[model samples]
Target: MEGILNAVVLFSNFVLIPGMAYGSQLALGALGVTLIYSILRFANFAHGDLMAFGTMFVILITWWLQSIGVGIDPLPTALLALPFGMAAAIAISLLSDRFVYRFYRRNKSPAVIFVIVSIGVMFLMNGLVRVIIGPNDQEFGDGARFLIKVREFKEATGLNEGLALKLSQGLTIAVTFVVVIALFWFLQKSRTGKAMRAYSDNEDLALLSGVNPDKVVIVAWVIAGSLATIAGTLYGLDKSFKPFTYFQLLLPIFAAAIVGGIGHPVGAVVGGYVVAFSEVTVTYAYKKFLIYLVPESWEPESLVQLLSTEYKFAVSFVILVVVLLVRPTGIFKGKVL
Candidate 1:
């Protein structure tokens, strides 16, 4: 029983907690992508870079605050800078839409054209972020690092394995829950939300019904920008911020969005956890876990990992490919890709 408890604690520390936090981040990101696709009818390849861009602002503001000795104890100062970051991201998003996407939208260009243009925008934002923040890891996390310390847990539980919960992880989960609830409420209940939904359902009919397309588009960008900033900031606080790392995050974010059902908000959130847990479970070394569960003589000599951590992203790719082949519409029956 003691060994069993230890194994569970170890698993939670290494896999469950991290997976939940990562899933929350991915869920937020995929939500942004799904929003753009659902209303704007195009895959914003620049979404990841937009996250990086917003995070860049957050980092800069955090540094400035720290320099002035301003902080909120037991919580990261980045939280205070978050609104500014969201504003910057929203401004950029609206500007891009006006200058780049609006032209295509007005001309009634094909969706493919919008996609290609997004890729171009992706490169430009990626470069701009790199130039501003440089290609290095930035650690802006401060204040309370752990909500539950490993030593304290071990002392209390008398277990060989200890569980440590990070403040960032807890914050990520909490913030995601609130954001998701608010988003769903707005989408289901608000007048603008209904208008947006109607427009998405049938643009021509909605236009005839006096639904303002411009207002819907602006609202969509604002929501997307806010999601991007929050997701990026939470992720940076949990792990570390590196421009290229966010770039690499694109694959997993897209995979989560598609796996849940592109253009489906609920699907995106569920797919995020699915992808996160799959990656963590596959890459985790389970030698100690098996040792605790199996008889001494039956214990394995080698690590029981299905794949190395370095190949974790491949898990997302595989899942994406499988989902695309088996159910292009995804788990929630989103639009066919």
Candidate 2:
């Protein structure tokens, strides 16, 4: 009974809640990538920067709002400013597509060329964000900090182990769920969204059927902008917002997009959770918790963390490698393009 109880607690603490929250974040981020990939037809390396920029906008707005004593009661007022952040991102994306990408599209440039172009766009966006934000960590998310505390959990459950769930995490999950559902509904049911999917499925057929590639691409960018803002802001709320953090996130975002199957919206969500769970599980130290379950004599003479937090990035790459070796198309038949 003791062993069973310990195992159940360990599983819950190390896997269940953390995985869901982290997965939600990944899914949100991956959705933006998948949308851009489907319409833009390239692996956008700069998406991470877009995420950074969006969160920065939210952080700035939050700080400004807080300074004026205007805060959302019960919930973080940053939620109120998220739309503005999203709008800023959308406007920027539209401008970028027009000035930086429209010519290439008109000239019928190769996908590889577009990929290289994205690198340039990424550099430009990165520089622009750093310049505007001054390359410093910004903290703006505030209000209703924690839904539950570890002490409360212990008192409520009468368990040796307890976990705290931040209000930010809860809000992040709820908002992400709503956004993802809305996105899927748009893609699967809305007329324009279906048209976009048709284009993604077969560009020639879509064009033959009178699909306006430009319009569809613009819509994709709009949706991607919204997603990026939400992902970046929520992540900043849950973790911390650092301009450079987005640069590091690009590889994992790529891994998530590929893992879930590129160009597939559903795949992106799955891949996000996969990446999140892998990172959390591998890096989370289990030694302290395990000692409670195992007898002293049986406890191994070493820490049980699969990998240290410093190697968290490696976890994503390793998963990607295995996925490619076993199933290049991803577990869900993501985009071959």
Local distance difference test scores for all models: 0.95, 0.85
232-308: candidate 1 lDDT, tens digit per residue: 99999999999999988889999999999999999999999999999999999999999999999999989999999
**Candidate 1 lDDT:** 0.95
- TM-scores of all models? 0.99, 0.96
Could you tell me which residue pairs clash in candidate 2? 261-334
Compose the digit string of candidate 2's lDDT tens values, residues 1-337: 6555766776776677777777787788888988888888888877888888777787778888888999877899889889889998888889999998899988998889998998898898899888988787777767888888878987887877776788888888898889889989999999999999999999999999999998998998999888988988888888888878877888777888889899999999989988988998888877776777778888766788899899999999999888888887886898765
What lDDT score goes with residue 253 in model 2? 79
Tell me how candidate 2 scores on lDDT.
0.85
Poorly placed runs, candidate 2 (over 4 Å) = none
Which candidate leads in lDDT?
A: 1
- Candidate 1 worst ten-residue window by lDDT: 194-203
Q: What is the lDDT of residue 269 in candidate 1?
A: 99
